[model samples]
Target: MNGAGSAKRPATGEAAASGRAVAATRTGPGGRPGSGKSSEAAEGHGSGPGKSRRFQAVTRDTARPEGGGRAAPGDAPAPARQWPLLAVLGATGLGLLLVAFDAFRVGTLLIGLAMIGGAALRWALPSVGMLAVRSRFTDMFTYGGLGVSIVLLALMAQPKAWLKIPFLDDILHFTVR
Candidate 1:
């Protein structure tokens, strides 16, 4: 076998199942049982064969989201490219600071709005840098869902709730203790 073939071929003398011998093609590359001789079998990811088996995603690197490109042009400074992410982070940080300083309601409101705003920006912009996680629709859904949830929870926080629905309280009545 050539060098490439040697690399591609799994080492022999390795096969088993709880100390019992198994077939070669069934044992997988590491001689580990149920390790997936084919990538789709082992990893349960639909990336198919070939490249999927070679990727050690847990230990190595994570593939960026489909739209994880620069917010600005390539020639622009790094900060400019990541302005979307920075804006979201800065707002969230400010919200956290306000909360730490004992301004709970306003702080939480700002935090939730910032997330909602981030979602809006992600939707409006083509290149949002780190703000782009997963595909565009997925990112939008995740950010919008979380932001709405946070905002709703903030508005419904104890004492004198602002946006109360009678049925909502009844649905969540298990927390009376």
Candidate 2:
């Protein structure tokens, strides 16, 4: 008979229906599938709330950026620990307040300076607490770009332009007219 019907047969279940191989021998209370996760773990997709942490090592929590620790050490005071972030925040706040008080150009300039300062701090210091909002390269790029943009806009404010770029006028004229 060539042992045609003597071949081993796999048990049929939900795992089989979904094309997932399951360990039919592993059982739990009432002979149910244990934890219903053994199969998932075996599949290397361990994103469930179980012991298997395949690619979710930091699940249920967020991670700080590479250099997003305290500016100072553990023993230092709270303010000192996050001095860089505080300084940037303070400067930005002051700039906003000044703008509210009818000091547009100076306020914008201060805001731009604060952004540049934040970038510099993030670069020069080992840790900058909240100032390190992203990776070192991303943080630096964002801060520097925003600072330069703000400063340029402030310098080129209406009535008088502190910075003169001949090509900019040509582009403006082409676009406006």
Candidate 3:
């Protein structure tokens, strides 16, 4: 066949195998799998003139600027202190232990107080490390609201009475049945 016809035919024999090897070595940026010119440029070769242009563009885009790609030494934020959150967590854990031992009234009070203290700490401190699971306003509202609710519930629990919600007993009776 003529040269044009031969070129149109599929690559076979040694040529096909070598082509596959070349394709396999053409890895992209970060050595990830993709089409780019860096692999050819790295081996001091190019598929065509376009390959060199692609390599130049890739290098230009990835080049770091004047400060070496990091903030200056004094520009970093200080590390957060965690003791106040840990103390609140410890108190809540102790309160749970008290509840397990049947000291329900005192345990509930302790838990509620701990929650209130956590809310106070969240309000007073700028950051609470891992304990700042939510925004400051959200943390304060949730902690304070739950603490007040728990304290009220503890005060009005079985065998005590300072206040009661109407129809709650009826709802409980209906649900239990």
Candidate 4:
């Protein structure tokens, strides 16, 4: 041999055996002869020349405000509370009972107690969040509907000499709905 043909390259000698060694470590024994490689092969997800390989390098942006950490303050949302509704319901329940039963001082006192009890119940019980977490929309509707009804009753009752209901009808109706 002379000129360009003077030299010959040596073979790597490993080929299939070398590839087998690599696959043996990465994959299990089923990757051999009769395993389920057929299905994987069909989908081009098996260890084959035609199969596509994927590599994903997980990265974090440390420059972020919280250094890309878990559960930064802004990640979680604030708990829900219908503040306006709560206040309105509590005040109206107490006011209505007080005025309606005022003729009998004992009755008025008892009604005041009941109103306080109702307020306690409303406060002690979970907000809509707990019901939503439990996927109990029915309970939410039930409690909400009862509160709406109470507000309605208070609105419809005769206006008390001490406290006049806020709106004549329009505003109250709109709000109740």
Candidate 5:
């Protein structure tokens, strides 16, 4: 006989079915074909303790302005509200006012001491003083003093105004320049 049946056979539906069977068996613990995932992992896709472990997530606020860039890691922390500092300053100011009403020179001395003590305390323990007197207060005090000094100098340069209230002009005209 000629070698009619000796050539390699063409792949038919039977070959396809057999190929699928081989692929099924080659899969991992799950019944799917050639998947590397485990049976437990496949079964735990939607509802299981392993859900969080299966995926990573990232989130950002939707309301950010259009031109805003990514936030820097070194951005400053939010400023804390400092009612305590305001309360302390307000109380001290009221006390000074009352004292001045009763005794002018003594009140002025006490006010000076209080201001110096406040500055010293802030210099000593900045972290604690940050809680007591906010940085804004210190800034306000510094600029306010400079502004008052400038105004007093402007007034003192005018001898006519100084003549109206000699003691008042002397007290107010305490600026170096």
Candidate 6:
């Protein structure tokens, strides 16, 4: 019986290799092939259940722009020119400044003009870069509405009776009260 048991038992090196083979073939808790937790650890999945896969490092090219080279990974995109938007903004700012100096008529006119121009730009241009604060339709409606309101307010601002809309006073009184 001792001789038979000895014959059946593998040598140390062979037994170690056979043990590794059996471990490799064993399925994990999920019964999926190669899903064993031990294999996951061997494949660089950490020993802890919460451990996530490690990220691989990426190499970037640092070639020149003039030589048809790609931009570096961290490089920021070039700013787009928005002359029309700048013009409108400048006009509106100037209008406010004028109002501060008590040039009410001129200031209101300038502001109204700016709104009208903004509406025109939205209608004509497919893309307004940074100037596009809202959808095209909304922008147009807001600009037009503000422009018309400013013009109407400016016209009625004078003390002259002819400039006043008949129903406006009643509406204003009703809303204000």
On lDDT, the leading prediction is 2
TM-score of every model versus the real structure:
0.64, 0.66, 0.49, 0.21, 0.26, 0.50
Candidate 6 yields a Cα-based lDDT of 0.61
Output the better candidate (3/5) by TM-score: 3
Give one digit per residue, the lDDT tens place, for model 4 in 62-168: 24221112221334444224342344455555656666766333334344444444444444544322222222344344555555555445434554433355665
Question: Judged by TM-score, which candidate is best?
Answer: 2
Model 5 residue 45 lDDT? Answer: 40
lDDT, each prediction: 0.71, 0.75, 0.62, 0.39, 0.40, 0.61
Q: Across residues 1-177, which tens digit of lDDT does each residue of candidate 5 receive?
A: 122311222112333455421111233444243243323344444244223243322334444222122221224333323333443366458647966687444444445544544444344433332333236356346534543454344344443543255676567687533
Which has the higher TM-score value, candidate number 2 or candidate number 3?
A: 2
Who is ahead in TM-score, 2 or 4? 2
- Give model 5's clash tally: 0
Name every residue pair that clashes in candidate 4: none
Identify the runs in model 6 with alpha carbons over 4 angstroms from their true place: 1-80, 170-177
Q: lDDT by residue for model 1 over 102-124, one digit each (tens)?
A: 98877898899989988998899
C-alpha-based local distance difference test score of model 3: 0.62
Colliding pairs, model 5: none
Worst 10 residues of 1 by lDDT: 9-18
Better by lDDT, candidate 4 or 3: 3
Q: RMSD for each model, in Å, please?
A: 9.1, 10.2, 13.3, 18.3, 23.4, 16.8
Candidate 2 per-residue C-alpha lDDT over 1-177 given as tens digits, one digit per residue, 9 for 90 to 100: 122211222232544576644444344432334333343343544454333343432345678898998888899989999999899989999999999999999999999999999889989988899888899999999999999999999999876878888899999999998
Model 5: how far residue 4 lies from native, Å = 71
